[model samples]
Target chain A: MRLRLTPRDPSYFDLFAAQASYLVVGANLLAEILGADRATRKDINRRMAEAEHAADDATHTIMRRLNQTFVTPFDRDDIYNLASSLDDCMDFMDEAADLIVLYKVDELPARVSDQVQVLQRAAELTAEAMPRLRSMDSLQEYWVEVNRLENQADKTHRKLLAQMFDEITDPILLLKLKEIVEKLEDAADAFEKVANSIETIALKES
Target chain B: MRLRLTPRDPSYFDLFAAQASYLVVGANLLAEILGADRATRKDINRRMAEAEHAADDATHTIMRRLNQTFVTPFDRDDIYNLASSLDDCMDFMDEAADLIVLYKVDELPARVSDQVQVLQRAAELTAEAMPRLRSMDSLQEYWVEVNRLENQADKTHRKLLAQMFDEITDPILLLKLKEIVEKLEDAADAFEKVANSIETIALKES
Candidate 1:
């Protein structure tokens, strides 16, 4: 319902929504990889990598459009950051998947599944939030929840680290688990950053 | 001497230079920690923490000024990113030192020092480059050298990982060392980001 003298394209919202949708796919692929057998994990990881590449392509398209577009929905840097952080979510998830296979980790601790569940939940919330960017409606709730979830994820990460050091016998295995868990933690932080960027954009718009 | 209609503040350059100087101090502290005994490293770490807090205060100042000032010399987000990446360099170096003492590791790999050396050089180059932002001169060489150094650091990082995995028998020690090395790598990447940000700012100005 807003009228502007300059024409502002809205497809950027669609592109963001599309980009976020890949995160949902990537997070789900991560969940699937966590449960599958070794052979099955390799297969799932391949899918995750493909999803990551797709996200990468999506990010490239957004950046290219940003370069060509004159008037943007928000600040140009915010768009770049939003796209980069969204890509970060996929990249961290993909890296977690890749390391799981590369290290040949047989079975992860139960808490890791807890970590992935957080990613899945965050991804769903993020995917749901993107389209709403068009309206900038009900975004406060989305960011608040993501912030809460990120805090939960942080506590879980620290406890998981302590638990791993306490229980895991082999140092090499502990190292592998720690790195993967850290990647998941990194992904969670990335999601939190995405929400923060949205909050900034919405605030400026309002 | 180009004439401008609007007033623009240039102290952001000085603030940035001040921030990069802390990096130099912190990087040298890390090198000192590598050579000293546990007690001495603790003493040095105390200084590093102080330096980090100083850098954090500088960042806070930059952000505050950015919010209050109507017109910045360049884009606001680029200033934010530049300040942030500079802070990241200090942060990772601080974390690296903190881990060294926290893990109580007796000795580090020589390549670990190699990693620190790279940081030292980058910090020096970055501090030198901050003042040049006023005129945006010779920045291309700065960023080009930084990119080249980052590539060298990346190669060294992978080799360090393989060597650690191959040589270190104690898994816990390996875990500690790996985390520290990775932090150093993160700092290196952060410097590259700083350089890249400068390049972006310079290009836009040009």
Candidate 2:
């Protein structure tokens, strides 16, 4: 088989990596928000908001590049989807953090941390994979790993939901915690969507 | 501007129209579920499951056609995003319906029907727009109207959430209703996303 090559800018990869890095920042801040005292959660929420804005900027840059360039390293739609999905992951994390503050919840379940860990790991994998997208080489492992993490997150989410309904008695507190957990699960789902988009690109390019 | 045309299949438009029609079916079923007695809610939920499944098939068909066709009526990525977004709207509606059943939510706020009405209108506009995709003409009204409906849905959603937190005292019931409301809001958000995708396609294609 012959190798097919196309003229494309490497900067798209740089922008994608930059965007994935924001997910890491957002996830860590989410973890901080979960573990921080009520006094400190406000500051963490502010930082998460800033991270989400930065991610949004990266997404816009990618979109601008997509419009100006005729030939891309991969499918234009895949690039758009990947960038949008990464931004979505950050948005969900921000939403989860914002809800914590908005609802004024003082306590969280231990499983919240478990889900954050999955997010952090997935973000790391995503950051590592974005640069390798230019070559489309050995990228299958990235998506596979991300998929596995998402599955683990699903299980953690189910367990947390069950525990929340079965154990929590305070009505307002239960409502707040359930929203937070659901947002975290949404972030996890968004990460898997990013992975799926990458897998689609790899399949078409390879 | 020069008129540039690519050879494309028209069947993809049919599939999109078919998918949008499912949203109508799902929306109507949701309205029924919201208004019906508990015994009838079960039957409505079953019908919703079927609509969701049918939407999934339409989505898969679009994807398969995307892979097989060379040139498309619009950007291939737009095609994928439009199909996926339509499917997502249905999925969120299905989730909301299932949650009502899963949580055994007895009474829904009046505003829930308001949001469903918005969804129904948006679905009708989307179905009407899909056929016009072939010429990419007179499609602007569809997205514009859908956007207006989405804004109305947002207002209804906010009002419902405030009402729930302000008046609902039962913890478990509060949690259940909040989840249901959030999912409906998400479906509205998804519909707006579909509209946004269509707007993008119109701008690019026209």
**For each model in turn, which proportion of the native inter-chain contacts is also found?**
0.14, 0.21
The TM-score of the first chain in every model comes to 0.94, 0.92
Per-residue lDDT tens digits of candidate 2, residues B119-175?
Answer: 888887887887788888798888888888888999999999998899987768876
For all candidates in order, the CA lDDT equals 0.87, 0.84
- State the lDDT at B44 in candidate 2: 87
Worst 10 residues of 2 chain A by lDDT: A1-10
lDDT per residue for candidate 1 within B1-206, as digits (tens), equals: 22121123437877898888888888899989999998999999899998888788788889999999899998887899899999899999999999999999999999988888998999999989988999888999999999888988977886787688778888778888989999999999999989978977876676
Interface RMSD of 2: 2.9
lDDT of 2 at A200: 78
Clashing pairs in 2: A171-B171
Shift in Å, residue A191, candidate 1: 4.4
Candidate 1 residues A52-152, lDDT tens each? 77787777678767655679989998999899999999999998998888777889999999999999999999999998998999999999999999999
